[model samples]
Target: MCEKCETGVEILTRNGEGRRNFLRGGAAVAAAPLAAAGFSGSRAAAQPSDALAQSEVQAWAARDTDGTFAPYTITRREARPKDVVIDIMYSSICHSDIHTYKGDWGMPNFPLVPGHEMVGRVVGVGSEVTKFREGDIAGVGTMVDSCGECVNCLADREQNCLNGTTFTYDSPDQVSGGVTYGGYSKRIVVTEDFVLRIPPGVDLAGFAPLLCAGITTFSPINHWDLKPGQRYGVIGMGGLGHLAVKLGAAKGAEVVVFTTSQDKLEDARSFGASEAYLWSDEEGLRSQMASFDLMLSTVPVAYPMQQFLNMLKLDKTLVNVGALFPVEGAHGMMMGFGRQSLAGSMTGGIAETQRVIDFAAHHGVAATYEMITPDQIGEACERVVNRQARYRYVIDMTAA
Candidate 1:
């Protein structure tokens, strides 16, 4: 049985022998679609009889702080009663992955497998799993698990769990007693609640980035309740910035792009910006001071925060989603003069993550990406750091 939670997310439930019976009956119903889709169960299935048994899967991992990836094998814990095992098809490289791999964020757990944005087909489910079935197109994002008893989790804010949330990779795993591995592998086993369903008729590869970049931008927009015809300013036209322009415009806001790259001005407009200007254009920037209803900065590097904050109208907000470092060059006067607010956001909670994915599908928004094989991850990381990638890079894990 299923019922809607306060966030309007359907919560699936079953108990005791009823759950086992449902799994036995649902297997055929699930397998029929997989067979029709040419899914061969030879390699994907993980129906281990013992709960303590583990499955060895092939993956690429960064052995050290150098961030170079090489072939490795990792073990996935057997499916628990509420688990779903996925055969990964594509995994997108997130900037956070690069940061973690390079130790830019801190000393990561060595031999880390860094990935979060992934889309795959369900291959197996635990005996009590009810929300997903074999062959469902599903995704896993930044988080895999959170302490469900926390007030934040109960409120559908698992990303902000007062108890530590288990990240997709390199976080202390509460369930397995080791660090969590991520989707840079051939397969992964995740709890059904953390797995997301991909909407039909969407580009699977293109949709992968929606798990991270899409939600990162949408959460802030959703939080601020950006209204139609409001002037929305986006800083930086990289991965997050490009998506912000697309999403902001889709929300009926008058989108504007403020980028450091002259080349991105036209590209920004193409992504749905009504106006595009170089951030270095002092006169051009000053002309629009206090004119924006909301502004979002997606630039990872430190820049003049006061400049972007100056663009907001009184009582308006400027949200930061990209920078992980200290924000400099802003003072109390910038905020006090207009009652303006500067805030930061991480990826959304599970329900909000699903909403963003569905929202993008309904509105035809997706990341523009370049495809590469797992072997190219090293080079791709370099490209990402150099800002050479057009927007995003998605790995074809099947090539491994």
Candidate 2:
């Protein structure tokens, strides 16, 4: 058995009865009618208290472009009728968090508490919330809310909502007025629809990266409809790249990895990749041209795109889940010859995020991560920026 599965077995042994009861309770609540739950379809009538009570909580924040984190305190709004209050246990550091803090993406709002991948236990639930209850294992990902009535949201693609999707942090907070504080803090209040239910027995720290790195890669795989025995390619072997390998292999694809680091080639193979190659392996890469049915690039920085696009089969696609910047070196001729396409994917929506979580649990796939205390967040972010993190860095919120 994999190490993740063995750890899960230990957790299950410890929490077996509680997990069963939690599952049963969740199902019963889901089946209950809105009327029985004291909820109504009207938005105005269902609104929570206008007073918006707030409480101060401890956290870490980046005060400037230096990206140095220091002790801070932020206020959290009390749970509304449709919200869930989670006491955060683990928060995973994502590369984007560093980008935002360092102003690489843009100048974020000052005093930014940067974290989106979080897993914790529910401590409070709004009166009308039916999806979760106190003591349930839950998670919050890259997004917190969206306009539910938009065309995209109606179709279950909340990430592309017509009005605008509210990100977990550094986005406008419709309720609290300034901005939404993220999971680097001790507690967070999120709407019930945005909260994800986590499988009971998995390692919470290992499972935290699934909120961002896992979903970012899985969304494209799902959209492309990757099938059994298909050739799959992943570029870069960082946090996102490794998860792509595990997820793709779990779906029965013959997964291959391409990376600049010689060390990660072997690591990729251990992560279920059928083959791994360095980008410098011109002969090996050229041999695989026009052979891949689908490819995903998880490199956060700019890299040559033409080589990967050339490897896609006719009518196939190379999806970019990272590199928010404009892609260069991808000429029209490279794509026109093969009738191939280049696409981009954001993080998954609510339902899709939940699906990835459940899928990871069932497949025994978990991130290889190093644990750190909240005080070490700055050093951890530095390591991530320097490409030193082996896979992921997860914050142990309970530690000093």
Candidate 3:
């Protein structure tokens, strides 16, 4: 019998209309009334909301391989209350991870583990967790913790919590009493608030980067709710830009891709872009000026924005998605003639994050990812920062 809210299903003691509630009280209670009778646990999902944690596990960690990455083994902590322990099936390598791991963003913690786009199942859940249970599929993204009582948290904008939001890795973990590690490992333990519930039927492997790459692109588009027939330009076609392309198209808007690479024109169109605007082409440049409702620049290098600002019409915005040097345009008034604005955004609140996931699942929008093993982490990171990778790279932890 399936319980209300699809909480779980119980094995019936009989068949068809003859069937009454069979195995009671748990999601994993197994077998048809005509056959065997025993609990099969659950599909690494569908676990009852009140099951115990499993024991023993494995993982791949960051190790030095001649200034590159090599494999090292690691352990997972047991689950506790409000905790959802995920056995990582896949993880994605992000540009931020590459920057932080190489110490290019500053002197990073040595052997600083990297990976926030993680997908897996709940091998365990803390005693008080009602949101998830053993075997339920789950994910953790760029953020992990926040001050629950802050204005942002109370308002469902935990990404901008009054206190600095705690990153999944490289940030403090109050429960662990130490710096947090990331999804590159075999398992991850996160609070119920930070963990995401995935819609069923998608491939779990390719879904990892959707946690970060998908959301990073997803947040800004959703925040504005730019409408149908509205013009939106996605500036770049790398990991993040590519996602923006699909998301913008799903919004029922005309999505234009702005790229320095002419070779990506076909790719841009293939990835849901209605049009491709080459930055160097005078015609494209002229058409972009004062034309778009929103322009999201995902290029990693600093670019002169005077031209970009000229492209926004009245009440329009040119938002920065990529964190490049020079920070913001030096001349704010340059954006004012058309009443245009310049802004920047990070990921999003847990509520917004959930909404994006649901939206993607509904629209069948997914990130394009090249899957690799842990040994490929270094090369993947290098390519990401060097702007060599076409879109995104997801680590297949199962292969590791």
Candidate 4:
């Protein structure tokens, strides 16, 4: 669920010192008056990018720090060498988008179009681009660029670029001129290296969230070397958790789901969980003590760490794929006593992200999403904020 879309924003805004400036810093360039950036403000018009040519495109944007989304126009850079111009077809809303848009991560680049889980058809490619071509289906995730020479990038982990990574939106784009705008627009220009090739038969809309949710869960399972026939526990049944259920089951693990909602038990079982237990069921929770070899948590808010830590076997791990908010009663003794480990993971790097896409396609796994038209942005945002959507909410750009 997108429960974090609302509550997480409140938490971060209250606790984070630099959050209010999220829009201020990026807004300076994004919301600048005409003369400051050499614009006339008459109508959306093409302008020079940091490259050869650029075009202003139609998009939905939040004009202020309040994050009320509406129709607005933004510009996208023209394709340069190693760049791919994509006509975005679908964009899935992630909780991070909510946090960023609401200035929880600090004020975002105002006039901001927030989206990172994007899938599209390529319309143009630069001279030096070899990874993708025109007419091919491609996808872009949370990041758009990173210093290729960095150690992490060299290791195929661009998400952790030592020199700092460029996010798909709200970051300075040296090559594009203004702060990066995401896929809420009709088109986006990204370097070929950062773009992903979608498999021929995958469902584009259902597959879009994999760019973020899929890779996030897959990276840790892959990193921990989850072997076949091992016991795996998935906590939470939201977007990330649902995918984790499928991926863990696909890996041949005896997957279990730990959720507070009894209604989701059927969904969890259908997603391949061998068993589902309610978190509030003390008897059910107690029966699983020191049982799982590994546990992956996708809960979007701050949760009791010790209870989850207790689920791990000796030397086992409980990996968190959700919010990094402060935990109220986290004590090292939980892990220290059992030799268990607690860790956190972010979205995966490029290679691992692609692996997730291909693997998911092979396993016939994808997000169960609610499709919304452009005009429904406000309602969609509210639905996600209230956790009322089925699982994920995807913007259908082609809808009228």
Candidate 5:
């Protein structure tokens, strides 16, 4: 359900620190912009990137403390025996990108190329790599690497490995001798181990967010063991909730949603919610308490703890997929009564991410996205921060 689009409330977005900029439309073109840097954007990201053959590759980079992103040229590493170079097509905008760009999460590495939900084709792969080669469609999500030999890595959960995971962007990668840059660039060089094959025929523009938003929502549902005929609830109607609705509905579970706007009622229904309730309708919500088997929250802001706790049935769980914020106090006895547990999840692991891809392929699930160009990235982030986007926003890297 595209609530923001339906209500004529195009999510409000402030400009690049007061500079007014509207999003560029259509698919990611990876077309080089006329920036001084002579960049060709995501086009240069294909595997075994042949930058030497191309005149330029365009990319968005945060070169200054002023906070506006500018176009620049990216030089791709030559393909090595284990290397797979991808030319980014589209990059999904996630809340974490907002935090990183705004310098809210921590001090960002300047010239920070902000993006991670990347989709592109394999333009080049080293001879040693059999999984991918020129023209293999793929995606790179939240993780890029782990130390590979830890107990957790051996268990196929690199994200939980004792050796801290190597994140796709904005984290340590001593091997690179620099903080890892992300998919906002026209191209990226990764080991074949980190690349994922994207299912064919899906809308590449809409499919961008599935790398992050899709996996984020699907993990908890699968982990929680949501089965056919089960009752589940999704809180909030933004990016995560919308996908949760479709996935839950596709899973044969009856999905109920709690939204802030009565305007979203019908839209939520389209996402497969058997029922929808406005959060402001306290009386109605209170009347039907403790009934959901799983209450999955996608809201990033704080909410009254006790009110939502009442919605869970015995042994039910409320899974938080959003970031940590200040939550209010509630009585331990209330949760103790039902043995209801509140848990949160980060991004999915590599293997689980693969499962998410297969699930989306089998179920025909994808994200509802607004495609923007590199020039519009700063604006897009501002829109997402201000809650003004229609579900999700993906940077059309091809337009860089």
Candidate 6:
């Protein structure tokens, strides 16, 4: 039986009575009874504040492999008994979004809506949903759902679910019968188990990137057991690297930044990095040899793995949070010499993601970002590929 059957049936019966009474009383019928049962204002909208209908959600989509974004209208799924409908307020452009949009990662579903860093307000809930209510702030990150019965999922590591995991966009949808449309839309319907509650006091726009970049960096830190006073080196000063600096510093680590561009030094330091060094500096690289306890490489392109391996102290580890491409011919002896290790990680599970959000808020940490509108998606994506964005770019849907 559905968990909320008793309450749900009661509500549905009252709704039936409401319709009958409305038919009898004509235009004179009061909406008080329907409102009390959770369905009143706006047809099918869970909350009175929602301005969108499930079928009228506007989105920016790439209709072909050309990767040009344009306005599109897509229908959202009807809210299920255990689902929540969100009216999207903001969506951040992640590097992965650009890659997927351009087909660099692979051929994505045409007419793709690419965005995972989503922030919005709950506008509707399923009858069985008790976690969220209308008018509450909410956020959605990379993966939307997984096989709940998988061993990894039971361990709270749903990202590594033994069964296939479902991503926010370009993923097959079992319910809606098409590839899932993502946060680059007016609204989305997600299961209650996958939606995260947004805490008060976080700048909603600034907090959006945390749903992706923040969790990407934070997961590795916690997985590797980063501790206060440990020397941590963050390679690359892009989206993931910038967050690593702030989160590592917040953990009381002596954070250093390794970058290819000399100009990013100030930007790195401003993000709470203790020092920034050009990775190209031979003398500087050698001087820091075997000094770091943990180093996170966020550079999306492959570089000299041996050089980074040389920076770790005995029994230390270097974790990669960026760059899905494989490194070519990295010398294993470098790590073997010092008993060091190299590893890779994706975003954290749902619980860990929530913990990262709360932890970042507690530290007053947020990604530095520039805001753009849906019309600017093409240019915004170009800037990210060109490494021209200051830190991150967020699509302000409120301005749409």
Best by TM-score: 1
Put the candidates in lDDT order, highest first: 2, 1, 6, 4, 5, 3
Candidate 1 C-alpha lDDT tens digits along 1-400: 1122212322222232322233234542453354325534324444445322478889999988777899889999878888988889889998899889878878988788989999887777888777677767788999999888878877678899898999999999888888999989988889877887777667888889999999999888888877778899998888888899998887778999988788888898899999999877889999889999889989877776987898899999999899888988877976899898999999988777876776787778999899999989888988988888789999988677
Q: What TM-score does each of the candidates earn?
A: 0.89, 0.88, 0.83, 0.85, 0.84, 0.87
| TM-score of candidate 6 versus the correct structure, residues matched by position | 0.87
Summarize candidate 3's per-residue lDDT along 52-93 as a digit string, tens digits: 343334544454422367655444455667777776777887
CA lDDT of each candidate?
A: 0.81, 0.82, 0.70, 0.77, 0.71, 0.78
State the lDDT of candidate 4 residue by residue for 1-400, as single tens digits: 2332111111222224222122123322232222212312212322223222577778898777565888888877767887878778889888787778878767777888888998876667777766655556778999999888867877677889999889998988878567988878888899877887777656788988999989998888887777777899998888789889988887778999998777888999998999999998899889999998899988877877788788889999889888667654567876799998888899987766766776787778889898988787767777766767668888887563
Better of 3 and 6 by lDDT: 6
Candidate 3 lDDT: 0.70
Per-model root-mean-square deviation over C-alphas:
5.4, 8.7, 8.8, 12.0, 11.1, 10.8
Count the clashes in each prediction: 0, 0, 4, 7, 24, 0
Candidate 1 residue runs with Cα over 4 Å from true position: 1-53
**Comparing 3 and 5 on lDDT, the stronger one:** 5
Query: Which candidate tops lDDT?
Result: 2
| lDDT accuracy of residue 330 in candidate 6 | 59
How far out, in Å, is residue 190 in model 4? 0.4
lDDT by residue for model 6 over 1-400, one digit each (tens)?
Answer: 3232211111211233422222223221132122223322222434433432345789999876656999998889777787878878889988888778778778888889999998887777777776666766778999888888878877667789798788889998867778888999878888876776666657778888999999999888887777778899999988888899998998878999998787899988888888889977888888889999899988876776778888899998889878888774458776788888889988877776766776787778998989999999888888888888878899988788
